[model samples]
Target chain A: MIDSRYKEMAEVGLAIRIKGLKKVYRLGQIGGTTLQEELKRRWEIWRGRDDPNTKIGQTARLTGETFMALNGINLEVRQGEALGIIGKNGAGKSTLLKILCQITAPTEGEIDINGRIASMLEVGIGFNGEMTGRENIYLSGAILGMTKAEIDRKMQDIIDFSEVEEFIDTPVKRYSSGMFVKLAFSVSAHLDSEILIMDEVLAVGDMDFQKKCLNKMREAANVQGRTVLYVSHNMNTIRRLCDRCLVLDEGKIIFDGDVDQAIALYMGIEDHLKTEYHFTEESRPYGRFSHKLSIERTVIEGVCDDPRIGQSYNNPSFGYGGYCLPKDSRQLLSNYGTIPEKIIRAVVESNDTRKKYIIDKIMRLVRMAEQAGQNSVVGIYRLSMKSGSDNSRESASLSVLRGLIDRGCTVLIYEPSLGGLCPVEGGVLVAEAEEFKSRAGIIAANRYDPCLEDVKERVFTRDFFMRD
Target chain B: MTRNTYYLDKNVHFKHISAERKWIDLRLGEVWRYRDLILLFTRRSFALTYKQTILGPIWLFLNPFLTSIMYSLVFGRIAGISTDGVPMLLFYLCSNAIWNYSSSCVTSNAHTFTSNSGLFGKVYFPRLTVPLSQVLAFVIRFSIQMSMVLVILIWYWAHGQIHPHIWALLVIPLSLVQLGLMGMGVGIIISSMTTKYRDLSILVGFGMQLWMYGTPVVYPLSQLPDGWIRSLSLLNPVTMPVELFRYAVLGTGTLQPVSLVWSWGFTLLALFLGIIVFNHVEKTFLDTV
Candidate 1:
């Protein structure tokens, strides 16, 4: 609940007051987590038995493993104040913003918000591909809960600010990425909302546009007297825009006060917390891979120690696949077909070669199993598109499975989501863990699970870095 | 800086968000507040669905026209089923025009969660606006198709081949309300449910197909032998609307006033329960979906 001090400060012009705010997400299974163990833990608690996952006199809740994304946060924001929230990755920065914006519900708390709220969690919230840019402006404004009169009144100003007057009637799908973000930010900036919740929205577009957005946001908070809650990794933006700051670490507020001191404390924690080791050129494990660059980039991109642009990580797999990765890469390749491009073409082709590699591995396993007098039924376990999610629409495992089946290999699927019939043609459906383990001579799991411990020797997986 | 006390005054509106513990949270007033959004969504559905097509909304007419032609060929000619004094083409066309309206409302909104999760996650609006707008738009589409059917019926009436009661006008409007609410209501409930149980989505696709067969869309209630099938079909909420509209225009199908009242009651009851379930699912569907 809100403490006495916060209540006192919030007595007059409280724009927001969050009390005992907590959000617990069911964390994705890494290695040993399972539904069976959760049930066992519940049964033990019923019988007054010692919990298997916890130490004596310690407490652990039943159900699958849960992560406290936001833990017992109590805050009060005054109207007309620009508050910056800074945090390392997975430090609940976005989760807190998401909650404040009402994009999600808190697991255990209540929040009181004053005035009409608008969020800029992404630059373009719902710009339909086929819709004209002008139509999307009205669409997004309506989506942001603005009245028709408000949109109609601000239409000219929004178009002028976006500088897309030449092609305003053209579909947004035809716009360059730069023009798209520009129009999107203008729509949000022109909104007459009293409270604005932004999550790294300033990271889009060029430097000039970023400066223009920062100025508009400053004008919104200062001249218009609107409350602003901004979350970003750019310390420079926080130092320039926010009058006050709050630093969150591991779901708890570590420092909350003046911007300079908060930045100092946040940076100090980032720099000193993680252990680092220096290695000579000769002392590295692999000659081809840089031992220092990966860790240095991870520290910089993740903790914001030296935040820059285009932060991404690499991991080898059967193919680079996810909900958007394959689709986006292929789309980019097609769009660049007239222009001479090498990397874009390679990005699309590399995935195919990786699938070929996986299929060859499965074929070798099948032949070996046939020589050993086994059925050689290759079982595929789970085909979630993205790690830490249940979506399986465009995952690498699905492509790999299709390749194996196309090559005339016996395929069996053991997805728990499906039963009675297999999802793919020419494959056996095996739902139960025990039955699948016994029937399939070779098991291919995209992500490793604890049930595969006994059959680990027979499992062929390309999950090099087992992190979701 | 000095602050204004009036900004945070207690009487001022404060949006309170919590773990919703209410049995019913329809938020109809909030949905009404977003009427402009509903209108825009309705306009978008009409504009985008048939964009870049050769015929555009003519496809709307072509769909029912072709379906009725097939029905007349199969059920009218081959099966030798009676149309109860109405011409075979007009009977099939009239039935399809009304039945297809409710069916479109359901099919379009059935995958609301799956199709619009990206939009839903990024913004906050009354989620009901999506389905409600589709229902409203289909009502307009249904009227256009109904007008075409009326033209055909007029040709029949001029020839002294058919007679329609004046009550058909009133019954048609009432039937639109009955069918729209029930279609959208059932659609959003299924959309909410299928977020967690995706298998339900697959079932809903075929379920609509099976539901049409169960109703008297292809065959008349009078055509069925007096047994469980006829009695079971009578209990179907769709039966009253379909039969009432047919009887109102053609004046020959089996129509029971008491059963019509029962259908209205069932529609209102289902619409209410569906709204509650949909509202409950809207808050947390992002997590499961």
Candidate 2:
């Protein structure tokens, strides 16, 4: 059966021939069941008892509830062809790549491949941080299926390509993130395999590196006569690199043929279904409060003016701060260079205004407590941006703490993940959780936890969402 | 057109890659082709492990030496376990060196799928290469630790404190290979099992500890009450190698013919089962793991 399939595939000059490729993944549990559960299920089946969990007419082969990641995918690729697979998240693009790489087997399929495959599904897959760049090149080369002699022959080329020759002997732990990706990509690009499979390797690094990678891939497919299977969300890169493309949706091939039409089909479906919006007065109220404030313009532009100064009590906190928003807003600002924009710039400034507003709020609370004749220690509950996380990077809580200290309030911090190790400079590290709760007159938290239930009355927060 | 034809004739080879349902597909040729990868993995592990350490490879020898000293103090003096007339240091060191090789091989290989899931999920090489490379790395470390045992043996031989057995030379190599294969087999099985049931991975550590006690590591097989317990210890694949090492060097261990056969049988069986499961798991483990 396989010999006949191979003969037919070879006659067509096909590099890859896949038929009826299906991958059904069992949800929730591993291996479908525990040993006891498996034995009991078998026993129950033997005794002619139907498992209530098993759907009627569902094949006995599917032991548990399954999701078909790739359902009956049939495709063929001509030799030296560059095939781009485009799909949204959970559309089985990665699952197809995983199967092609032979990292995971399809639930049912016959895949007749004509050449050695080198897949760069993830860059730096086995990079030891302690190993030097030179060592990592060989290790990653071997991992990508390059022989030792092959790596030795191409070592200089890889180093030159990555442009990190000076730091080749330095441990990769010391290398910048960009340098690491450069070295990883260089090794992968140097793999002398007959077929190359890649998944979004261009997503990392700068535009220059991305261009270099794309050029190298183009060389691999066009110059070297190697078959290439590329998966990416970047339609421009897809059009540039691929002659043929496959559009996948919910584990089935929705469109297959010209790259442009496939991308258009994918975009048309995605763009049309996306939630539409209009900037009317009614909808303007639903706009982010920071953007609304920027539109209101009570706070003057380019004046370091606090946007929160005259805001009504309904405005909950200044704006989102944690890890994502500030960075995203700044990135958005960078993208809008020379383009006229007001609200984009204001959203970035609103975070600073919010911190200053929080400082003012803490000062008022401290004064209120002092006037009522109580100790005025400000307890900062959780330095983490979110509850149950140790990440304090760009945390609004830390900024609030710093602001409170600048206003001359003794700050007590309660961060469980840090234990007794306080990261803040010149801040009191409260070792005991209960001691922190008892010492402070007012406790300020970015997000509320049920642990603060007893002191809920004393706690001050603008957490209206009750989520991260 | 001629050049293209020549290139196709030379490079093209059709393969039917599919979901295999068979119990075993021992692709030894594929493994052999990627022999360079095995060596590189071994080198990478060896180099990366001791890269930043000041002691470097010296720690390999120092680790077992310190472990044996502690074992001698506890088992020899404190607990008063007999080494069956062998010197306390030699017995402890011999068993420690051999046990370290076998146990580390199993422990490292058992985590083969879990620890290297990131790498395994990206590339395709013979999955056997990973556990095989781990076994080879452990062998290199074992050789270093073995040399230390040899140095102590020479010292003991010089003082006429211990007699050397010629048969030990033959038994030692055989036992070492047996121990390695046993470790590889058991490790492969655990690695495959843990890919699905992660709870098995945790149990493996505790199981190895209990397994050490069951084997004749600190105490000789002769020291155990000559009944079901002794016979049970003999049935353990690890016991044969530990006893054979002691019997070969010191010429003082309960080396029964039936037990040796049983040990060999168990090792081969475990290894056979391991390869079957490993071959089965490598194909689909990415999805489950």
Candidate 3:
């Protein structure tokens, strides 16, 4: 009864008018106060104030550090128009859907939606594992904001579509996870929602179901005149489904015109989008343990310090933090071992003695730290190898940690939450910031946390930008 | 159905996305809109818990009976946990049922995000309905458990073990509020964290076990020490619901005046924080999850 009243309250015959659509997410903490937290923190120095974001009972959390997932963006989709959001991971594609569905709020932007929205960001959300397949259909529908009457009306359609009617009354917990996904997706697709925002949900289920989802989305756009926004890494779907496209990178919209241009921008093929390789590991920190490592220097030695110069080379080792290199670099190094030493030297010399000079400089730092005679724990800020890649496979940090441990200094690793401690068969996980702080006599931080304010007095940090 | 939409024009070429309500009201409205979903969730929860078991729903009744009997053996006959002169079985049953309801609400709901991240990432609905339905399902189990408690009371009444009072009816709404705020609060808090750091989700499962021990489920609330432990017990919003349940059933309890106040205060605060954090998280949790 009330739903109809709400439906009636909406304006009639007004098309969607999206304008100045922006969504910015605080990457790390909840209560980030400003736009330039990382930059401001670098220049300003005030100590010992409590991070306002921390709750009373929550321990070891830092404050004032965050990253934006989506910057101020704008878009407009006509009723029944199908729009595609194309981006790589962390490109704010999903964040836009969340903002559209009212699942999350934009920190500094506005959008005017035309009608009710039902977003399928993933398959089988709002499903009850304990419930039977039949019950979950109703539950999922209700979760999609459908009424009981509507769910009942469409129940048979859902059952037939999912083909799980045989076990409809059986507990869903007994169903295979795949079966569960099918049933949940079928219910959402069948239910009536005005605006459908999908985020790679069709990737699940069997191929048959994927085809069905594609057909349904086409029907939703063409037959029902429903507006749709889809986010996916799949290039085929983006081409097939979108009439207009928006491409995002590093939280900003690089392209918003034709689907081809958007795809080209997302693929980094457009000249405008390819200004400089702006995505340095220096722009944003990676994952929970970004605090564990930092890059001290990059050296090409006898050659110039230029990656573009080395891009064409068969094999080259980018001088890293005294320990290890990236996997690709390792592959290149081993592959280079097969080449003539003269060619290797030639390749090194072409960069202006850059690689050797870098190695010499880094070795000097290692010796200087060892000679300082302080028993001071020299924290090897994570062996800075390359940028943009989180899977730092040939991590210099791994070697540095081993080296520090071999030297008998208490080495505390604070990187990605490891399943097991390195080298040592038995070692404690120093999870708490305070614990990590108090236990280490001299802290080596690749990145910094404001929570380590008290211990920063004894810490050695190399975080200039705080990006990975 | 009304053709009215917030902003739609047959002649216009496009649509925009916008959100209006504050985070709290938005979540609350979502919970309300998905009330039917909650019912479905509760029904599914009830069925699944008992699937393939011969006793099925009957165990709902049997669990409290067996528990009460065990408490009678240990507390009544062995260590002698005081029941304020109420029959130990009746006292234990009353407290146990309420605690069971409260704990189930917390435990099941606490994993709302981690358990349903697959669903959450793919769909848009009021996330609150998941926990809300859990409370309802626990209530259904409570109803079964209550019937058994009543049967024991009938026997005790015939033998004059205790007397029933009209205040017993307050258990219904009180249980609802206790379950609603407590489950929603803890559930949302846990859900927010589980999206990024999975350690809390693992610990929460075991924490529920320890938490039950802290709660006076097997014994009466009076047996614990008088200082911070007692005050700390009050901090668990479930403490009030369990104590009041016994007060209603036994007509005598150490149901602290402060316990009720504390429960209400904590429930509101936790619930407020939960909604805020959850709203903040739901936006980008998909990337993290």
Which is the leading candidate under TM-score? 2
Residue pairs that clash (backbone atoms under 3 angstroms), model 2 = none
**Which pairs, if any, clash in model 1?**
none
When sorted by DockQ, best at the front, the candidate numbers are: 2, 1, 3
Every candidate's CA RMSD: 17.0, 14.0, 16.9
Question: What's each prediction's TM-score?
Answer: 0.70, 0.72, 0.59
Which digits, one per residue and each the tens of the lDDT, describe model 3 over residues B185-221? 8877887877766666678778888888877777667
lDDT of 2 at A76: 92
Interface RMSD of 1: 6.6
Candidate 3 error regions (>4 Å): A1-18, A21-68, A87-90, A127-132, A163-184, A201-212, A232-239, A260-468, B1-27, B52-55, B166-244, B254-289
lDDT of 1 at A25: 84
Q: Write one digit per residue (lDDT tens) for candidate 2, span B188-226.
A: 999998887777788889999999999999999888887
Supply the global lDDT for candidate 3: 0.58
Best by DockQ: 2
2 versus 3: better DockQ goes to: 2
User: Chain A vs. true chain A, TM-score per candidate?
Assistant: 0.53, 0.57, 0.50
List interface RMSDs for the candidates, in order: 6.6, 5.3, 8.0
| Interface DockQ of candidate 2 | 0.37
Q: What does DockQ give for each predicted structure?
A: 0.24, 0.37, 0.21
